[model samples]
Target: MKSRSLQPQLANLPNYKVRESHKAKHVNLKISPHHGLEVVVPKGFDHRRIPEILQKKQKWIDKIARQFEAQQEFLTPTAADQGVTEIVLQAIAETWRVEYVPTSNPHVVVTEKPGQQLQVRGAITHTDLCHKALCKWLAHKARTHLVPWLRTVSHEVQLPFEQASVRGQKTRWASCSQNKMISLNYKLLFLPPEVVCYVFVHELCHTIHMNHSAAFWQLVGEKDPNYEQLDAELHNIWRYVPVWVEH
Candidate 1:
């Protein structure tokens, strides 16, 4: 990680911190509460071009910064305070408003209620149990959406895998095993549809080339023309995941 002072050329741009991430495939801009503005660059990215890049993206950076400022001031209660109020599965384009009801049952249960809502009943007072129940529901949703999506991509790309499973991996988004089994992260539900497709294609390509060699990249490009940008977006998309899922 490197933090650069505002240079004369960057005087017009907002001061930002730069971080190198192994997952990043291209330069990406991120705005967070703790860090006002961040420029995530690849390992060998040229630092000298950062000023020019920031200048090019000045308007977008400013817009996101303003939104962050507004969020910080008017931040609403989250799972930490009460319970998860909403869950968004962007990969499937679904938004579920959550409702909590205290019940006499010993364990928490999350069930789909009518009108795009989820009802969490039984032991709602136990925040940990409620979160765990929600996480289980999220995995179920991932299987319902992601498994079929991966199968579709595999059919289209002509890359076949033996089996696919969902997991909550801390550092990996998805992986393809040696025996042609694939594991996808449930957190992928938070990413955009296109990015999720890229992950699927990435793992499917691994069935052909296990390593990220030139041949692997060529295959990925054939499947996803916009993979470079989508891959870079992954490094910044973890912010979209709800805190309850991580907890």
Candidate 2:
């Protein structure tokens, strides 16, 4: 077993990835419905034994992978799947109307208008193009909405950072650098307000303490008492993201 401390370590396997969490008190293997196999361990865990452990759990991993594959097959939509004409920005509590217009050239142009309407001009026949336009618009919405929200939270909590940015990350909701710069996943716009606030406070605490030490979590708890619940809720929020904008 590794020494108990802070900071998680990532180990990529042949088929999946393992994230060793410092807070983990035991050797635990999790098979995510979205991600594949993840191995969590207490800090100071034996790094060389991961392969052996995975080999021991191969059958379980295979079973879980099959289950996830079946679920994804059902959840994944076709390109022509019901065009997403309306969406709700849960983080900001705003309902948006999405309008799609077809164009001749293979290009997508998105314009944000008044009255919570987004105009997507592109090759509607090309669902890929339409999806692209919608994705671009989502990013724009995050930049316009999330970045400013972070600034406001920083001010409210009196925890200032150098700057903030939004990106389309596949595996992370948000991150903070040693230089005090924070990067937020644009998909956070899909999460509820409380969960979004928890994420912001989590990263903001990172600016002061880079690791999830006792002191760090103490600060987070002080800010948001329900952070534990909110953090747990984040694990399943991907299902709420509009399918077209997820890519």
- Tell me the TM-score of each prediction against the true structure: 0.70, 0.75
lDDT of 1 by residue, 69-175 (tens): 56553343463456678888888999999998898999999999889999999999898999899989988999999999999999998999999999988657899
The model with the greatest TM-score is 2
**Model 1, poorest ten-residue lDDT window?**
72-81
Clashing pairs in 1: none
- Give the CA lDDT, 0 to 100, for residue 21 in model 1: 69
Error of 2 at 228 (Å): 1.2
lDDT of 2 at 247: 45
Model 1 earns a TM-score of: 0.70
lDDT (CA) per prediction: 0.82, 0.74
